[model samples]
Target: MARRNEALLRWFRQTGWTQRELARAVTRLGQARGYNVAPDSSRVRRWLEGERPRQPVPELLAALFSERLGRPVGPEDLGLGSGAPPGGELGWDQRGLVTALQDFTRSDLMIKRRDVLGTTAALATGAVLENRLRGWLDPVRADAAPAASAGRIGTAEIAEIEAATRTFWTWDAKVGGGLYREAVVGQLKAMTDLLEHAYPEQIGRRLFRSTADLARLAGWMSHDVGLQGTAQRYFTFALHCAKRAGDQRLGVEVLSRMARQMVHVGKPREALSLVALARRGAGARIAEAEQAMLGTCEAWAWAALGDAGRVDRAVGTAQERFSRAVAGDAPSWLGYFDQAGLSGMAGLSYRTLAEGDPGLAGRAEPHIDAALRLRNRDAYARSNLFDLISLLGVRIVQGEHAEAERMVRRVLPVTGRISSTRTVDRIRPLARRARADAARSTDAARLAESLDGLLAV
Candidate 1:
């Protein structure tokens, strides 16, 4: 009954793959991500005859096509669905970043998940991200504001916005951004309205910096709540505003945050690319605290790629840079990247590596423990909860299922209180692993059951 999928037929022919071949390829790709996919020739034949497969099959097919063809491919490209890819890529509008921000916020306020992103973080970026990164690496001056509007906000207004942003940021770490992201989005919309107006050049730059910071926080919160497409808009908006304000520190941080999102979603190569750009853009003048942060991001990306040596090197560099940072010397905006933060990043890096090799779980536990020991549990309740989960993961992988079972009791309650979708995202794979090992150990089965409950929110 479907239109016979001419688009899919064309790609199938171009790839020179038979129905069986495509089926096998899709199955292999799916299995790599732990999906129990077992599609055969008949399934691929049905697809060609206009039967669209389920959630991840279309994504897998698109990824396969992209790889074989050496270009970006989305389900829509094969006429299987609609748009560019699941993680939406911002086109970086030609009119201006501000215009794009305005348009994005308008749609966001309407509560529609309209953008097209990669089907999953599992899909390789292929050419799409490379092209975007090229644009990021190039120079492009922002549009100048039309002559200043008569009414203007002064330093006091800028400080207030900054203070508000700091508060929202703290909320993101303390309670997760699930409920408050809408509020942050509304605030950003207001900032965009003010940007449309004008102030003194000094006042304007400060305002833009504040807006950039607010937008970045919005991005972080959106991501916390699992709005990846919406989050990308805020991240790019932050970059545009930071660069427009001539704040290298803000720009580098924005890029770094973007990189973290990429790594979070399983696009490690793209994550590494963003961090490389951030490092190069920061130059030698960048502060030690920022250097440490960037190094940790770089380490995470490398760990995703399964390069333990590179992870070690990056972790070492981060530790050294963090050591060089004078107490209270980092820009106030970077206050979160303290000793606990470094240890968490390091622990997370090893955790990422160990996920692929349970033998390496030992590398992760010490740092995770150190982070838990140093962190202020009350102030960073959400972050502490995430660390606790990470520690549980280490225990499970280390075959210390009894200890991991004990941890699930502590972590499960706090996890329920925290609204972070990232906590869910982070734990899902671990839960899957536990479930897989459950047949062998009663303790692992129990751990899996407990972890599964925490995944509900």
Candidate 2:
């Protein structure tokens, strides 16, 4: 005989439905969903005896329980299967994806799962990339009902969330991820709570779009702080939210950001594939600025892969497209991809190219300088700092040891104020290089000592 499912038994009892009545309910639910499922009282008995229901049935049961409980539910809640895929896995079905994000965000906020939050693992295989792309391409389902709850949500609340998201975004840009990670998480929790409340369909869509933007920003901040696993989960959830909002462009944006993360983590090939997926999703009708942003991302990936020709072509395309972009033509989320953002990415791409060909420093320096000059130091401190460090690295590679040392000294004091581990990691290489060259120059020796002191913090 099969073992009983105690969790299912408890939920069934709490629901107060006879096995036959539950069967009838499942049948009606399936009919309403246009699925041919017809579980009977006997089927319910088998489930009670721990026979796992198949795909659509488990999803339907979760939905039923969620409706009755006035909260989102999942297969794992009923002890039906191993817990849904971790939130970082972006290829799950709509309901499973939403439920996974809810659990992951809660766990991240509580700091209960350090291992999950701290990992830097990459899981962007071709199959996974294709799966996510297919999901993004799918039309939004029309049958999803507005969430049910005792309280009503309005557009004003959504406006507040949007304003808050913008505030956190600006803070992250200026103060770095370490300063705003907790605040972003708190905002996400509030948005998730709002999602649980009843609202009109139009308001619900707006809420989801805003939430998607916030989730993407949270992922970016997480990446900035070197919490790659946490970042991946946030990006996946942002994609889910964009899909729910029927915003393909936002989904494409999330994919681009994920591609950027992949490149940073040394998975350039995977990054290239992800960028391709984003382009495919955007198709021919995307705005020029969005096209330019995607092109720059592609250039970054190609530069990482050491494809100089492709990088040049891609960067040129990005620049040409950006020149055609008018103010307010792109979406609000794409606002960051203006001239300075493009210059920063171009500088990064050139820096990557210079790694294999030191003579390329001449080509890279102007872009890096332009990025620094174009960015507002107060509003975009972290990015400006990063560009400065990149330029320092390029100078060091060009054998301008004394100049590089002075630049490092000038920036050393600011690093203490910024909380990003990534910034420190980027600076460490220059310190090591300076140390290695100390025997050749007294300035190098002194700079190395100062850098060591800076790194000690």
Backbone N/Cα/C clashes per model: 6, 0
Compared with the true structure, all predictions reach lDDT values of 0.77, 0.77
Candidate 2, 1-457: lDDT as tens digits: 7678776776677668899988998999899989999999999999988787887787677666655543333455566643443222333454554555555555456443233333464343567556645667667765533345644667786788889889888888888888888788778877776676556668877888998998998899888877775687688789888888878799889999999988887888888887787778768767899989999899989988888899899999999999998887788878777788999999889888877788877777888889988988888888888898889889877888778778877788778888787787777777888898899988788878877877887
Give, for candidate 1, the lowest lDDT window spanning 10 residues.
Answer: 115-124
lDDT score of residue 416 within candidate 2:
82
Poorest stretch of ten by lDDT in candidate 2: 82-91
Give the Cα-based TM-score of candidate 2 against the true structure. Answer: 0.78
In TM-score terms, which candidate is top? 2
- Candidate 1 structure, TM-score to reference: 0.77
RMSD of each: 11.5, 9.9
What C-alpha lDDT, on a 0 to 100 scale, does residue 85 get in candidate 1? Answer: 22
lDDT of candidate 2 at residue 455, scale 0 to 100: 80
Tens-place lDDT digits, model 1, residues 1-457: 8657766887789789989999899889899988888899998888888776886787778778766754344555566543322133433332245544554565466433333222243232647655544455456555556335654678887788888888888888889888688888889988887877756678877878888998999888877777675576577778767766777788888888888988988788888888888877667757888999999999999999999999999999999999898876667888888899999999999998998998888999899999999998887998898789888888888888889888888887798778777888888888999899999999889988887887764
> CA lDDT of 453 in candidate 1?
80
